[model samples]
Target chain A: MSTTTLQRPATPSAVHLTFGRVVASEWRKLFSLRSTWWTLGLAVLLQVGMAAILGAAARAVAASGQGTLPVDGVQAASAGLQFSQLAIVALAVLTITAEYSSGQIRVTLAAVPRRTPVLLAKALVLTGVVLVTAVVSSALSVGALALVAGEHISFALPGAESARILAGAPLYLVGIAVLSLGVGALMRHTAGAIAALMGFLLVIENVFAAIPWKPLQIISPWLPGTAGSRLMSTDADIAAAQAVPHHVGAVLGAWQGYGVLVAWAVLALVAAVLVLRSRDA
Target chain B: MIEAHGLSKVYGTTRAVDDISFTVRPGIVTGFLGPNGAGKSTTMRMIMGLDRPTSGTVTVNGKPYVEHRAPLTQVGALLEAKAVHPGRTARQHLRVVGATHGLGARRVDEVLEMTGLGPVADKRVKGFSLGMGQRLGIAVALLGDPSTLILDEPVNGLDPEGVIWVRDLVRYLAGQGRTVFLSSHLMAEMAQTADHVIVIGRGRILADAPMATLLAGPGQEASRARAPRATELAAVLRSQGLTVTQTGADTLEIVAGTPAVAEAALAAGIAVHELAPVRASLEDAYLALTADEVEYHSGVGAPANPEVAR
Candidate 1:
């Protein structure tokens, strides 16, 4: 065609921009990418796969010992956090870093010029999606563990400690994801942000937690990665760590560890929003 | 309407956009004309609130772009083509941006059809060609049914047909009593589509006036003349305080009327073979305007860029 003209709608719509609408837009943006689905799916697979193997090992140990090996089914289900957390790292980091890499940040900033609303909306969407996905994946991993361990593990409704432990998996995963998103926003590069986050969550946290030094031991549980994972620890899991020779990590309640992770997320988000507000798109 | 007052942006020591002010009124197309590094895109980005100006204020409609109740409705800017995630389909990207203003899927589909991207609405942007990417960008800009459109290099990657389509589309939008501001380095394109023009060079306003005034340019009539000794004739014309540029081996274009050139050649010893008045084109005016800017911004700009295309 040589040329064409657009016909505006006869009646113009009265658009009212609200924070909820921004959140909705961010939700659409997150779901439209295939990477979001693949990474989340991998998290579920890793958690369930680890649950199965760990459950089988518990059953084998019980058979060899001539005694019942006490297995917390929920703990076995979430045993793969170390591996699955990496998937959430990739997903959350990509959520913001991909926008920067592809130059879509300009379009987004132009649409919502207030700036803070955009990052807040992204954080809200990331938290909501990760919370739901983590909850469902935890349930699936529990089922896998119960199936592999048979009667050796109980899937019955839990006591307070077990309930907290069961809820901890999703809570910890969501915390890590939101934290990663903040880091992504601050770094503004896909590979750099992902590597920075992965290094802290995987190597740095573990290294500080296992060094068997007094100050490192005291500060270890306060690190987001170490403390956040502790959110899924049952009472027996805490006691088991206490039993380890020259234990180099702090012993904190599940909720308290989750609180520490939330603090880290909040601090990162504040920094990200500040940087976003001050920096040009 | 868009109004910028004393707007300026500085990157390190370079003044990307100097303290400049201009107004783009509704019901007419305003062509933002500039050279390759003329800060046209930077100024557009500043208007869109994508880049914060170092000093100055710009407002769209009646308020700053960020202050609008619905920014997208007030102004739709195509800051860059392919400012989209490759993994998402065109429809998905449109829907995502549209959702920010509470726009629904119906409007998204309407824009897809309007931009002639309906067939590839569901296709991932990664596989789209440059022209397709540009069309998708226009669809996004049109999604909100915005009253003001700011397009930076809208025809950058379009085919001939697509280029004509955008030229017509912007003209149509301006005719609808909306404010349409588009930037381009193509002088001929601006001459065809714009009713008003603002020419920029080296981050400063070189000229701003109606299209007719710009083409008339400096109130000088350009005349063409051929002489046996053209160089001697040029020296004599320069002595008479007339601007002259050598166009060919034996021809000179004098910035004086045909009578003035004939009188000067008659007074001199050069025998004039042919003499006539020539119409000044937008390209000539534009080149002349930028040629001055290039000289003023020496070292950074070439002395003469005769090969700068329209």
Candidate 2:
């Protein structure tokens, strides 16, 4: 039906837009940029490298038999998250913000006029890519910790505690990545969105959690950063949060913390969708 | 075909696109001509659904652009040049946009070659000159093989060769029963390519007519009189109640009949070197039609519009 009769069917052939194809388009866009791989690689390296380093320190302290090791082997394996999450934050922000910086959003919106699907597709691709990175790096981190400080920290993968720790690491990373994606869409500027997310994760959440007040402590667990951190914590870590004389608050479990993080992501995503549809591209 | 009914856009308090309605028919090239900040881009954006109209609606083919099952197939648009992520290679950019419509690599390569961009298909778009970027934009507009096309300033950054290529391409597409709507600041270029023209100014439609009728204007016959003593001929013609404007040292644009100018020159003993009737070109017609509508005027004759903006 698209045949032009004389010049190569200028209108081409039968083809139409689909949700599946938009997902594919998002995939291609994410992989085409060199920054995506470089930043993601940094995230993996930070996670694994921190796990091994923290595991060795835990082993040394135990060997001397002097003081209580603050973090267990499970916590050590995921400790790299402290630094690796920054990489995830940067990557997620760039995923959506780069389009606006380069004036490509207009072209993208033109292709997919419904607007909401573009954000959904981008979130899906980001989740898929970051999940793979988080899983592989987190696993390697667990292996490295077990290899170096296995006996000292009683590290092994077969137990329920270790399994939850391993699984939670990737989910936590994916959550942070999706959360950053929504913020980036709302703020449309790379540095500005990164600053806002960094402030929320590093400054605001930590400040409220540190204040020695009951109500603030109670509400701290609801903060996305504090809630998300619960996913990677060991029993010792949870106990420490409670032991703080000012820590009279709800003790969130791993999945529960992850659910809170997911809720934050959903809130940001819904706001992005509404703003994107109503505002001019 | 493209239809707009009372489509308007208000950015903050400024009416970027006022209430304007027009039809762009199939099988013809319709030129959207306007001065800077005259709402051409805003109108085109409203039609493409890039910017929502505040008051009314615009539709491509038969329904609103967003309602179409395949928007790219319905109307491919190049609203601005270089609307691409510079970090990605040219081929990658096309592949990503085309994938939304389920268009494959074969078609991607076809468009790359068609736009004369095959050699640089794999190169990042960061280094492309303005002309190359324009070609890439046109390449994107053609990716879906859409039946209706909207290109705003399609030849803004093209070289002479590229300009001619776009003209011939638009004409050929329209000849094949496609709807081609384009906006350009180049008056001579529109005069050459567009069969019908829509003149817009200050967010309003000032003139919408065929090429010939617009150029012919409102039956105000103008004659170009060139004589050795043009000033003397002007004085004689002015006394006869004729509006005359000195276009050159020897040539005068007289808003009168050719016979009157000749008779005045003959009576004044001024040698008439040349005298003939003149039809306004699109540029002249446009300037005359938009004399009062220009947003910003250099000399002190036109009023300034406080609301128009980039």
Candidate 3:
């Protein structure tokens, strides 16, 4: 057991109260809670499980020489990442919304009066955790898949394509996590945030895609999940450009897709911060 | 010290808290007295920045709560019985809050010990009884050794022993020159613990004065004259320009100058069977102030008082 004596100076200096301290405090809070560990564990499980199954299936097809590899080995290895994104998104939303549900958000805001710093701190920590987990999970998934499949499926390591996939996968997850976190702040309810996230990803975006309106088709790639998915699969753009009628690259250039995803993440985060600062917890 | 300047809050159409203002001074326990739904919780929430006021502002020391650097070090508040996640252990909860200010594990354990939670600090909060949860909330309030403390109904679920402990704890905190502001409908408890009192009724300030003054003031003297056949006394007092009411057949309440005056009247050949001075209990005074503003009046008839029936 640890005991702390009262050590506040007779007069506390202003230097001790800063955004840096808030960030540090938020980081501690983010990791100290048990939910963080659970989410990370789920991320790892999904990454490894999805990668192994897809790698095995790809290897069987490649060994028989039945047809050219339908997807790149790296992409196959990272297939599980799509499922793991849900866990990351859930973790991010819960980090803020749970406080609201339990009536503890007021305590948090009281402790740190500058609401933006608190939100920013949470976002930074979420991004850091999600990125680290995504990278490590992607690496392990790819490595394990290669080991199981043998030499038939080979992908260059640290190469431009591999780097893009590796870097972009985590970035995409972090972007999605931020976007969800913003929505969570705006909604201030776990059920509402989760519902909105699912509605946007599963229903709204698809509805937009199915619409016959030409303008809607042009705007479809800007949807949060769609933009994120394309960003993580840069190689798909090159493949679609050669084999498909509707050139994916023309609809949204590689850089343009990345920009759209980042813009969505940033816009959501800004709106969340504005609402958090101006409105009551 | 904590000060509120024209603080008010509105929830849609209902005015939860009106333009009320009061001050809580250091080195004393200030009891915020009100019945249920008197905006006590809403006012406290605003002070903690959990709820933004519709108008005006509240400041601890000289600045708003959010503007204060080292907020945990400046003020500690126990606004709820169990503002904790069930999966986290008591020690973990303390440690997490402590870590915000860069405090070490030692501080967490000290607070656990202080609140008598050391034995169960390792246990998950899910298994805690209501009393244990209240203790944890107090422990969190004490975690920062803050100079200002705000506790809303700190004794709600406490056992007898736990209740006594909280009483002593608040007194001790005040003794250390800290500002302790607490709200409770338990007037007896407030009578014992608070040095000053702030009574709110329907989100408006009904009274703010020293506990001694409030207890010995107008309301107390009026209730002392209630008794059967006291209408004669009311008639006599009315002739003397004193406001009087016959509460019951045997009760005549007189809001006269003082106990000595009422005693003098009885001595001057008044048929006074009961000259008992109705020193208003804190409970009576509180009810009197908030009676009109009680949001949910249970219309169920009161159970017959056996002593009164006799």
* lDDT tens per residue, model 2, B1-310: 9999998888888888889999999999999998889999999888888888999889888898987778888898988788888999889999999998889899999999998999999999999988889889998999999999999999887999999999999999999999999998788999999999999998999999998889888757889988878888888888989999998999899998788877778777889878899987777788777879886777565334332221
After superposition, the stretches of candidate 1 with alpha carbons farther than 4 Å from their true spots are A1-13, A62-71, A154-158, A237-250, B219-221, B225-256, B260-275, B292-308
List, residue by residue over A176-278, the lDDT tens digit for candidate 2. 9989999999999999999999998989888888998888878889988789878777766677766777447788877788899999999998898889898
Chain A TM-score, cand. 2: 0.88
Superposed by TM-score, candidate 2 places the C-alpha of residue A196 at a distance from the truth, in angstroms, of 0.5
lDDT of 1 by residue, A1-281 (tens): 00011112223465746677778899999999888999999998898899989888878877887654456787788888888888998898888899999999999988888778888888888888888888888899888887878877765435887788788888888889889989999999989998998999889888887787888878988999888877777776777877888656567777788899999999998899889888888
For residue A115, what is the lDDT in candidate 1?
A: 79
TM-score of each: 0.88, 0.92, 0.85
Candidate 2: fraction of native contacts reproduced: 0.91
Q: Look at candidate 1 and tell me the lDDT of residue B126.
A: 98
- Please provide, for model 3 over A134-190, each residue's C-alpha lDDT reduced to its tens digit, 9 standing for 90 to 100: 888888888887887776666754478777776777888888899989989988889
**Which segments of model 3 are wrong by more than 4 Å?**
A1-15, A63-65, A156-158, A210-213, A234-236, A239-250, B220-276, B300-310
For candidate 2, chain B by itself scores a TM value of 0.91
**C-alpha-based local distance difference test score of model 2:** 0.86
Candidates 1 and 3: which is better by TM-score? Answer: 1
**How does residue B278 of candidate 1 score in lDDT?**
91
- Candidate number that wins on DockQ, 2 or 3: 2
RMSD (CA, Å), candidate 2 to true, equals 4.8
